[model samples]
Target chain A: MGDNLISVNNVSVNFDYQENFISKKQKIHAVNNINIKIKKGSFFGLVGESGSGKTTLGRAILGANKISSGNVIFHDDERDYELTNMNKQDLKEYRKKAQLIFQDPYAALSPRMTVRDIIAEPLEVMKITNSRQETDERVRDIAAKCRLNIEHLRRFPHAFSGGQRQRISIARALVSNPKFIVADESVAALDVSIQADILNLLKQLQTELNLTYLFISHDLSVVAHVCDVVAVMYLGHIVEMGPSRELFKNPKHSYTKALLSSIPSIDPEKRSEAIELKGEIPSALNPPPGCVFRTRCPNPGVDCKGGEITMGLTEVEPGHWVDQCCVL
Target chain B: MSHLLEVKNLDVKFDTDEGRITAVENISLTVDQGEVLGIVGESGSGKSVTAKSIMKLNPGNTSYNEDAEIILDNENVLQFTSKQDLKKIRGGKVSMIFQEPMASFAPAIKIGAQMVEQLLIHKNINKDEAKSISINMLKRVGIADAEKRFNQYAFELSGGMRQRAMIAMALSTMPKLLLADEPTTALDVTIQAQVINLIKDIIKEYQMGVIFITHDLGVIAQVADHVAVMYLGSVVEKGPVNEILKNPKHPYTKGLLQALPDINNLDAPLSPIPGNIPSPLDRPTGCVFRTRCPHHNPEGKDGKIEMKLIEVESGHWVDQCGIQCGQNG
Candidate 1:
């Protein structure tokens, strides 16, 4: 009853750009030494800017990206599989347990395929269920769970709006009855009104299925509404990890505070000056040494320059962990 | 004094394959010389179309009804049919910034070149003067290393930088009016805020009439002096920002304001408007929002939708037949 669904222990993914026969390679640390724990039935959020390597961390957990080092273990009620060292057969089985819900619903989905086929593709490819009737029933069940109209199952992706298409994407991801799902910017593309509808649906599905989610998005407000716990990433390193409310209320990192301040207030008279970041997000290929955020940090000190950026989740308060300033 | 820009009883139609579709209808608003006017609506609400119409930027198939009158600086821009007049209106006086920065900027051309070109086109400035003006504009938008970045192409810069570059280019001409259409929707929240503040600053510095078009209520609340809440291409509610935000009159506007996630109040769930934006083909006969209006009757008597825009309070307007608004108020 007190088991963890997924455990990412200091996992890092590095993409090596090697040239000709000389083997002069450059390593781009996309996800650098990230440690996160997803509870059996919890919505965990991973938030950062575009080049923060949040998406890479999600992919590392999902086994889409090659884990350069460290352990990523998936512990179910039944058994625990070491994700980093899984063989072909074991990895294939693990694929069924952990599925990905892509961000761009339009691009992720095939225009040629009907909604039914899109949903049924997973079941058929995985051989989870035999026969067309079985596939049809399974597709319908998941589609209904995702609040998709069964009548529209036969329609093409073009016929549906952005929100409806996202629902279809969700249905396809959950058709195989996966225990864990990574929804990367799932509602970012949708309109504000539609974003709420999708968020409601996701919450409902999480409770109904008792599913674990690794919701990745740059939208802090949306993350606040749904996620139980959140990890703030900056240039491949997670600077802060804590409960959503705690993080929102008292952000430890300077970047997190700046990000929080940037959110526009709905009240007309209550407008505050947004904390403006000076320089753009540095390139991942040629990342700055020492603290990855030192370039953009408003309160950067001498320690931020030479000190190596590491993810040490120090207990800021009860159940709240934040990476402290190592230089001091 | 009269407003800088005045749009009254505006109705724009496009001849599509289906039929003549009314994109915008009965939108009446004004923007003072130094005031920022926000026109907000969801997709298919004709927010962008309305802004484009001010510059006479509508497509060839667009059929502007006779009832509409778009007056810019006491001159009727709705009747601008010739290319020369439209050009003068577009870049010379009323400059625009589009949503997709990459799509708007040329892929091969340097950011500096494009800005200088835009400046030269409208102002007939010398090459050296244009270059200096472009660099200054870039600096104004908070672009670090403006001199260096001016040489870089659009793709070389990040999304936020590209948008800043776009704004710098648009403002370089020193246009009287800035028509920004969903300018910051594509950027991150942090970037969006930066752009919004930059726009606000520029609007104030230039004392220019700005019409900011967006789907976000929060943004409009922050930047706009007066906001016109649009639904199905018509101005449902038009008033001061405070009035619109604190006490929204229109059902569509109320839905939009409520839909925004209130960070201050965490207890209340985001109340997104139920049902999708109605298709242009299936637009209602009477009120455009009647089909999706939660308050209006779906199955009314006499096959006529009775819901019409009514001034509910001293400066607030709303639909007449609000079924679910009493509880909301």
Candidate 2:
């Protein structure tokens, strides 16, 4: 196996937003110059708030979102595939190697389809198995791994609860034997106990299948528990990136620190004097120059307002990277 | 000796197409002026139902038991039949901030106009006075461009701004009680923090009794002075926030605390409560939580154990689930 499963180098994805014929066209910088390398079988987390572009970045790596600049490289045992420059057939082949688990289980699955049909659909579309018997076998295998029994395969999506429905969603994603998966807030909709159950299931599957995950979520606590490497994104830019333990222990960027402090704790003493960022996150359409977080940064220097920091990361510690402007 | 709000044996049932279903059962809690009582629970726990019952905001299909009482400032809210009395309770004496700000707001009306209309109806104030008061409230909630926002519709504001505006409108009435039902659950973490801080400051400034309802225990620790942990429409555990968090007596409470992925201790495997919460129709006989409770004693006390709250400590109360009652009290 290669050292890195996926290498995203200086990739940026921007969307053209034009409300109507009367309105002026504007560029929404969804993923701007992000650089990340996911080691084989590592759980890499993309953490951010709403409008932080974490999901956009995840979709870009999954070859779903159109990239505006740079490239994405997917490394396998045989060869490396340039995801950004794939033809139709190559793209279809790449789709089988990678998959996405949606956030809302209720909306992801079709009500008309039984659990077996939902799981088998992925294999059928991906052309993984030949006949109905083979498809059924693959469906049952993945469902059992996801903790869904053979009896559950006959029932429609409405018959299952939120957590069970999510298990069905996961089984569908894994049925194609994907090497990598992008779980986009997969457990965000479930209750706490169910959320934990799903998280544990994900971890167990990862080890069993030797899977690499790009776990995108707004919750830092959940990310802390599961992810081996973490990247903190804000307003289309990655503010901090490093090993989860190191980054959580010693966060360098101001935005990273503020985001960490925002996680509410069960102990009242822990939340006291937390770095309460001023104002809401700025829109990606017209983010503040220099540092995007300058508007809400707790301590912005005089140069921060107008002076744009060089658009790249500086390794502050052994394996930690922070935006240069935020290091000050 | 009178409390700001006291809910005595609040039993709520809804007449559905099938039959009458118990939505909330024998739930009781009190909130004094300048105090915050947090109601923590997952879905089907009926925390929101308990909160809505205070303002009697549930749908027409709902029916309260004869012994159920919702007393607000010594007035029985259940018996309030007159429109004026109902008006006096809603927005006059009690205000509610919902999880979704857009749902509470009138989409067609200007933000300022709705605030002014509520003030005009409840406060016997002039239009000019109401407008100024509404603008002041908008400014107090830290919404920039207060005048511009006042003219804009609900769709114009961002999620955070909409929540702040809702909070401003809810507090502008200067009510004695505030029922915040998952007010920050929809917002992002940073926005959630800002809204939480705003609520804390508003509580101190206005001294409004707040009933904060959410599934997150972390939020409960931040905003609640006292907390009630609910499970399947019953308060499983009730105590001071510190005691409940640090040393929970109920198995459900302990399970909930352990289920949350502790940021400090990342290595410990998450122990989710064993199984899915039982469907309401198939509610467990003895204790509602017994189906999934790790400490479930299969042999119940004669196949019937009436749910009762046992005073375990000076202030703390836990449900008399035979397993925990004797050991705790």
Candidate 3:
């Protein structure tokens, strides 16, 4: 794992919540003991349904969410820093190095701000550049790379379409010259045609800048297309993780298999098998004691519910890790 | 195979503070009994507006062209004047389910009460019969403990359950036409699959004509018999689902298909349509898709290109420019 840029070791994020004044407080295990390593310059996909802890994990890595346990290590050619225990100054530096692109382009950009100002915001906030001229140059360079017209920079965000606004957001994310980016549902809100455009732009930028991306989304096909490595999360645990091709072609976990089968096929003649998971996802507040997915697992047995199951990754194939309990 | 609904030369416009915006223009489609017409388009493509116009569900500021005809069972629905007459057509002849199920339900009211109220308005059934029918519909939609869930409010149920309740309520009246506007878009993948299967089964059992609108071509391919590809308030192509998916004729259709990341072919490069869709207020002159079309003649020097729908194959119609552009390529 020497080439790995970020390594998450047994990381967990817990949130305390109360129903009302009368009810006792409860700890919601948003992301339970998870471990994964993302290689440098690779597009790693984090996929799950809502409440699967994918977003929480992404936030945890970006230092937006407090990690209750374990560590997230960020490595580069210059230095290495543990994100979970970074000092104030180090955290600020990490902020410059790692950035985020939001989901809704309509809401992500400030309506009143011109496209130039929106893209230049990170530089101004972080004081990464010395003068306005430098910031303007950086913004223009990234905007051009993101395929935004130079003249459109003077107009407000409201004048742009969804895909253009997304490009503006991408330009903003890229202006900081970050080494890693967490694109949380970045293309989910755009039209399918526009989604492909943004995805192609991201891929192109990744190659040009040598950047790593944590692409988080609920859409499996989109992830299967762009990502080099794919990790499937259920509840708070990663049930399956492997190279994109191997994972989609030959999934080991039952949950992963079920999710793949659930996608409505584009081919009219090829109907997916009836492998629907029953019941809604269990609440994170008081998740089932044992395997979090046991309730919805189609092939669960007594061992699945006997005791609390900690995630243990077993490499079924080279570089493909699946939960041990799922295999056993 | 009789026609259940026919929308001819429909044009919908909204009077906003800025100006009048045309949402659906010169659009025509027909649905036969037990047939599913899948309308696929992006967010602002007017698919929802087309579905809503069948029942005149738009706000008071909406205006329709005088020649616009929405005939339901051979009766023009747009000409309905009396509130009672429109009500008879709305939930009686046609029913709709929206993307957000929670917004569709009355929050303060119990699910059972809301469903019962809809039944009472549409049918001449007694309270006991309505209650039984509501519970049975809930059970049919695969909700567990239908009685308990029926008594609960919309907030009490989960997302999937609420959507199921919405479908149950929509289908309870047994309308001749069902307009589902991205009903499963908000659902999880597995849950969406379940709901899609449920809708397919219900369509079969009731023999209801359904106009399913969604942004997902995959979902349309699975359930729709015929499909209409919309762009900038116009249907660029209309054909059988299999034909459209397997061999798309329109450049936009081909671009859309090529853009999709196929799970089976992970290494294939996606070819996205270049340039953003023009804002509705700034629609182009000739073909709406010509702005981003790969086949557009950059140096043709023609003043304006007139595009018309031409049948490329039996049961498959594509815009003239789309075919011309493809041939040039």
Candidate 4:
């Protein structure tokens, strides 16, 4: 991958328990060992249901989470840093190079701050600008790029609709001029018609800024439409990874098949035989032996009852990889 | 043919800090026995308000116009004046399931206790009979270990299991109609698919009418026999599901179809609607969708909002447009 921007190699994030009296000290494996590469300027997608650890992986790459092991390397030209071991000054520099856009526009923005202040907060906190005049000029330039009316900056987020508030969020994320950005479900709360408008805006901005995005969402349809490369996650693991078109057309894993079948089709006459997996998702605290999917796999047999899981990522075809544990 | 439920010129209004606002206007739809009617619209489309109207579950500020008569079978639900009469019609004649299962259920109360209470209040049933019937209903909905789960609280169940418990409680009384308001929007896609199938099977077995409201058109295609597309506060179009999906005549409906992510056509880009919905207070005159309609072009510098509803085709309709179709005659 000549244009690889983000290199995540065997990174794992675990949340520590602080309670004093629990007999079995517990640690939540929010994100297990994961390795992937995001090409420069590509709209890469990370998709999974809640509690699947997709969000944690995105945060770990951004240096937002405490990584327990492995390293996340951000490469642009020859300037690559080991994110897990960065010092205070180096971490500050890394933070300026990468930023996050939260899922909830309403809660992410401050109610008391004006739009202008909200966009300028990141610059002020990072101490990137020396004077107020310089800060205002930078905010105005990014606001125009995001298609926000400069006059709207005088108002608060409560005065805007869901779509408008999202625009302000985009301006905040882009004002830092970061090389890599993580947009976490930025348009999931907006209407369907508005969702398209926001998506178009993001695509246009990506080209203008020469930015790489890690778009995280559970809506596979949206992912299929927007992302260049897609990764599927289940219970803190990526079960399948491939180009968007390839995976949608010929999904190799049974879990992928079930997820694809779940998307509602607009054509009433077209109905796929949906795979109904009985029983709830097992707790991550105590995962099952062998493959995590073996409990729900319809093809589970005597071969699936052991404690050993097939390791390594096997390439089924060009640019497509499925975990070895998948029976295919 | 007699319809299972009918709303005649229904209008619902809410008094807010700004002013009195109309949420649903002149809406009329009929659900035949054993048929599924889908009300499709995004937020602020008043899909849920219309469903709530059938059960008279709107807020105190909501006032139904005098012409509004929710006819269940033949009796007007609004005419049920006394508490006893309203009670007989509410859970006995029709039952409703909501979007959030946790919010709908009492967290402190045991699942079995709540079901038994509903049965006792509606019908002249004893505790022993209600408990047995509740357990049987839970089993029918495919809940394993019904006896053990019956004693558990709503918080003990998972998202999918909680929804099943809600369905069991709602259907135990065997109402003639079921009103589901975005029932599967909160669940995961796979879990959502299972719930959709469960509702479809139950409707078939009982032969009861259903009013399914959701923003997802894909889910509607799988379950609905008839589909009604709603804009701001009114029904833009209603027809057979296949006809509307294949050949959408209304501009708003066309935008919805184009906005959807086509799982079959993975290569095509999604063309989302360009603008947000106008607030009800600032609604454009004539056609409600003209502000967002790409075909509506202002001829001069005036650039005023277009306000005319035009009938473009038989059994299909659209607002006045700047685009010339050559079939205006």
Question: Highest lDDT among the candidates is held by which one?
Answer: 3
Ranking by TM-score: 2, 3, 1, 4
Candidate 4 CAPRI-style tier: medium
Which tens-of-lDDT digit does each residue in B1-329 have in candidate 2?
78999999998888888777887888989999999999999888999999988888899999999998899999999998888889998999999999999998999999999999999988988999999999999999999999999999999999999999999999898999999999999998888889999999999999989999999888888889999999988888898898889878888888888889878888888989888877666667777877776763545433366678888788898877843533532
In candidate 1, what are the lDDT values of residues B211-244, reduced to their tens digit? 9998888788888888887777767677788888
Off by over 4 Å in 1: A18-24, A305-311, A326-328, B296-308, B322-329
Worst 10 contiguous positions by lDDT, candidate 3 chain A: A304-313
The list of candidate 4 runs beyond 4 A from truth reads: A17-22, A305-307, B297-329
TM-score for each predicted model, relative to the true structure: 0.95, 0.98, 0.97, 0.94
Better of 1 and 3 by TM-score: 3
DockQ of 2: 0.78
- Any residue pairs clashing in model 3, and if so which? none
Least lDDT summed over 10 consecutive residues: which range in candidate 3 chain B?
Answer: B298-307
TM-score of chain B of each: 0.92, 0.96, 0.96, 0.91
* Model 4 agreement with the true structure over A1-328: per-residue lDDT tens digits: 5689999999888886644786667887777788999999999998887778988999999988888888999886767878977899988888888999888889989999999999999899999999999999999999999888889999999988888899899999988889899999888887787788788899999999999999999899999888989999887778889998898889988778888888877878777478886666677777676667777765654655464775346789888988777743
Q: Please provide, for model 3 over A2-106, each residue's C-alpha lDDT reduced to its tens digit, 9 standing for 90 to 100.
A: 799999999999999999989999999999999999999999999999999999999999999999999999997788989877899999899999999999999
Candidate 1 lDDT over residue span A4-78, tens digit each: 899889898999887676877888889888887898889999999888898888998989988999989999777
What is the RMSD, in Å, between candidate 2 and the native fold over all Cα? 1.7
**CA lDDT of every candidate:** 0.84, 0.89, 0.90, 0.84
Cα lDDT, model 2, residue B94: 95
> What is the number of residue pairs that collide in model 3?
0
